[model samples]
Each structure stands twice: as C-alpha cells, then as structure tokens.
Target: MPTPGFPPSTLDSEGTPIWISDLAGGDPNHVLHVVRGIEAEDALEALGAKPGLIRSCELPDSKPDEWTSLPCAALGVEPGGSAALLAGRVGEWTFVYDDSGFTYDDAVTKALSADGRTAATSVYTINGDASLTYAVDGEQVEWVNFDDLELDEGFAGMPAELRAAFEAAGNVETEDFEPGEADGDILMRAACALAGLALTLDDVRRVPLLVVPFG
Candidate 1:
C-alpha cells in the first residue's frame, strides 16, 4: 500500500511516527543498523563485540535518552570508550540500535554486509545531519546524505527501483516533524524500505537481544 515501507510509519505501537521524530527531537544522535540474514549474536560478533560482556536482555522498557548510561552501567561498561548497543533478530533483519554513535562508521556498515549479509546503516549526528548507506554481500552499493541531499555516486550497481525508493524516502514531507526532527527517521525509513525489513515499535520493545559493549 504505502510502497511497502515508505511514509512515516505509524502504529498504536510500531511503524514510523512521532516516536522516531521524538527520538531525533530529543537526542538526534544514534546509529541503527539493519542486517538481513543474520542472527543477533552473529551481528554483534561481526561488529567486534567481546563475547564475554555480551548479555541477554529485553529492550529497555524506557525512553531512549536514559539508555546511554543505564544499560552500559548495568553491563559494567564505562559507557564512554565503547557504546552499549542492543542487537537482535527480528524477522529477516537483525537490528542493532546504538544509543551512542560509536558504531556510526561506513566501514562497519560495509563489513556487516560482507559474506552474504545485506546491511544498511542510518547515522544521525548531533549537528543535525543524517545518512543512509546500503551495502550487499560486503560491498557498499550507495549512500545518501541529508545535509547534502545528494543521491549521486556509488549507485551504479543499485537497481532502479531501489534508487527510486531512496529518492522517495528522502523527499518525504510531513508536518509531523518540527525543524530538523525527521532526518534520522527519514534515513531509517529509507534503510528499512530499501532492505525489505518490516519493523514495528513493538518489535523494538519486545525483541530479545544480546546487549554488548561495542567499540
């Protein structure tokens, strides 16, 4: 109906909506990685997380702002040198949400996509810029940025349909967001839509994951 994943998702509990806009409105800094065909533990290990510190937990039943310190402290992590992230398999995609921007690297995004996994990364910066990078089987296909608003470069291998979706995801307009409040979610939506992941806020809330102190 809605092009499979475009438009700000909304649900009584999931989809894109004020929840995402609110996340950006409050912190505007985080990294969300969606990797297709990988388990939660494999996703963490792929990202260089130590196996010992990895702990099983449910997504915090709290707001995102409190996540930075609370989870890391509980995991005995300093919450400074490395980021405490939540990773889990939800359907065909493994979602990793980094409250701290520690995993916000293009190399890391491509690395996850390596060895037969398809991955997409959405990076939201405190300076109000955001980006979505799409990769396949370990190679970077393309990347688009909110600040520059450019879709050119690294798109040669990407299909026309996906490229068009990226265009659509970036150009989404809604009064739901105040100034600069939707960039992160927009990129996130683009990533999910492009990668064919159906996500809900309830899944984010209810999924079982291995929490890790990731550098």
Candidate 2:
C-alpha cells in the first residue's frame, strides 16, 4: 500500500510509471521548468537572456550527456559526470541540460522552441539504492542517503519539535530502504521534514530520479 502522506503514481499509456513531485503545488521559490524543442541557444534567447551573460561547462565523460557543440563557451567548474551543461542564468531561474541523455519529450521540446513561455514542471530521480541525486541552481548534490541522513547541525533551521521527531525516528542501518515501503516512507518523511520540504509517497518513489527544490 502507498504511504498516507505521499502522492500516488500513475502509469502512462505505454505502462511506464509516471511519478509527479510532491512539491508541485502553490507558489514555490525553486522550480524545474523543462524547456523543450528549443536548442541551447534558442532557449536562452527566448528567455530574454543576454548573449554575454551565458555560461557553459565541460562535464566529465562519465556524465550522462555532455554536449560538445554547446552554443556557449565553457565557464564555471567542471561538472564531471554530474551535469553536462549549465546554459546560463535568467533572472531568478537557470537553464541546464545533459547532452548525454534526453530528459524531456518531443512535444514539450517543440512547444518550448516555438514559444519560450512553455515549460514542464520537473521532478528529480532516485537511484535503485534509494540514494537521491539533485541539483541546486546548476550545481549537483547527490548520494543523499534518505534513510540514514544525519539530522545534526545541517538541520538547525528546522523547528525544534520537528527536529526532535526526526531524531526519534531513528536511522535505518540497512543497506537500502525501498521507496513506497514502510521503511522508505519513514525515511522520506524525515528527510523532507529536515529539508523543510513537503512531499508525498509517490513523490518519494521518484527519488534517485530528478527533483527541483523550492526555498
């Protein structure tokens, strides 16, 4: 059975599991808007981004998708296998992509290319081992062990009561905690609570996938 606080998963017509983010509602400070169809340059232009302000980086070969013919020059630290490209920053939002792999569909890409205003809300992915890899802005943060996360000083910003609850939840010493299961559910709640994030069970399952945070 699905956890109480988590959202439910849906299956696409092809029987592929589709998981939505638990953080999709209300107005969020951080969001993942997949700009489809638009080439790297076109997407930036549509966003009103100035030519001189754009930035790019060369990611390591191990990374998912590294685009060799990126429209902009390489800037910032080498993203290694974490991210292939950080196109540029537009106002409060940043544009990013992995030339190594495709994250969006053809229709979404077409819409984004045709009109700069079109974008799809994105959700991060969870790995098979229940580890979460995500990015803030364009920087990558990964290998987060949801079950055994240390709720020490890093979580000082959380409420006292919430912190205490997470501490009381104890840590999972097991190698992995399967998402959607009871153990995974507990860890997911604790992690979200510490990060001051609200997510559903279905959202938790989509971990090790793709997630965009909102402050």
Candidate 3:
C-alpha cells in the first residue's frame, strides 16, 4: 500500500529506503517536474530545451548510467551541443535525466515553475558537493547545499504537510560534515518528496523516453 504522502517504494514517516542513493538506483543527476496539468512538449519547452531537437527512443536496460550515452542518433543529439538529456513520464510528472546542463540555473527552475508546475532538482557532483532545490509556480522555495545544509528560504513556501514530512525524513546537519554518499541519498529522496513525486525504479528503467539537447 502507498505511504500516506510519499510513494509506495519511497520514504515513509520514519525515513528513506537504503537503496535511494546507490549507483544501481536513481539517476545521479535529475530534475523531476510535476507536469500533470501540462503536455509533454510543453514541459520540455519549460525546461528550456530546443523545440525541434527532441527525439524518441527506448532505454535498452536498467542501467542508470545509460542516460549519459543514449544512442546519439536516436536521441537527436546535434553535432555541436551540450550533453544530451533523457526524459520520461512517470504518472503525472516528467522525470528528466540531465547531464551537465541547467541543474543549477535558477532561470531554468523559475521557468519550469512559471506555468504552475512544481520542480524538484538535485545533484551530487563528483567534486564532493551537492545541491537541491524546490520551486513552485515560479517561486523558489527551497535551496540548500549539502556542504552547509542551510536552507536559503527556511521552508518558506512549502506546504505544511511536505514541510513537516521532509523535515522528518531529511537528514540533520552536523558541524563539520562534508557531503558523502548519505548526502546523495538525501538528495534523491528530496527530489521526489519536496515535489510530491512518487517514483519507483521500474518507472525509469527500460522505459520509453524522449531525448533532447541540453541547451
């Protein structure tokens, strides 16, 4: 059965599953959008992808790393473009696996939420740093880095329910804590929990997907 607020296989009132942050689990870099009320093409445009470059394809296996090297031709990747992005819909929202794109661009997050859609973005860079953001209707509500764990807005615009639930499952801060795998796990759960997403492993692995240029 589904947890009260979180997805069936996601977090609970107690905590997140141990599997959320592993290489065998969620994509390392992603921006999950609550696009239920919008169309797929519109959602892509909102993320600032080039309109004519979108391609259709299917994932061959369940590897999370495949997102980085989706068939070049099948993904419609241009000769001189930034990294390619893969997108797939899971229920009402669209899950986008981004590679070296706009995960940190405040503008992209603003545009995505401008149309009343919510966005949850998270990333753990190889340099031992991590970032997470939650936006609603063009307003950035949550912005924090694993290095500091200091929320820029202090849960200002989050709904009462999400705020409390996130506070519970999200990790607590330590004085000299540098981010590690555990921090990455927190990001995976936050990307979904903060945006009210309910993603399961089966939803992304080997799913039919849309590929677009990062720019």
Q: Which candidate gets the maximum lDDT versus the true structure? A: 1
Task: Give the Cα error of residue 125 in candidate 2, in Å.
Answer: 12
- What tens digits encode model 1's per-residue C-alpha lDDT throughout 3-122? 344433542122343334332224546777889888888888877888887889754344445434444544555535667777777678887777677788888989999988788888
**TM-score, candidate number 1:** 0.73
lDDT at residue 215 of model 3 (Cα atoms): 53
Q: What is candidate 3's lDDT per residue for 1-215, written digit by digit as tens?
A: 12244443554333343223211222433333443355556667677778888777664343324433433334544322565566666566666656553445766666776777776666655454666666778888777566555444455655674465455445523343443213334555566654444444445554567777675
**lDDT of model 3 at residue 208?**
61
| Span of 10 residues, lowest total lDDT, candidate 3 | 17-26
- Which scores greater on lDDT, model 1 or model 3? 1
Which 10-residue window in model 1 sums to the lowest lDDT? 10-19
Ranking by lDDT: 1, 3, 2
In model 1, the runs with Cα more than 4 Å from the true position are: 1-25, 63-82, 150-161, 164-184, 195-198
- lDDT (C-alpha) at residue 21 in model 3: 29
Cα-based lDDT for every prediction: 0.64, 0.32, 0.53
| TM-score per candidate, chains pooled | 0.73, 0.24, 0.64
Q: Which candidate is the best by TM-score?
A: 1
lDDT of 1 at 27: 50
Candidate 1: C-alpha RMSD to true structure equals: 4.9
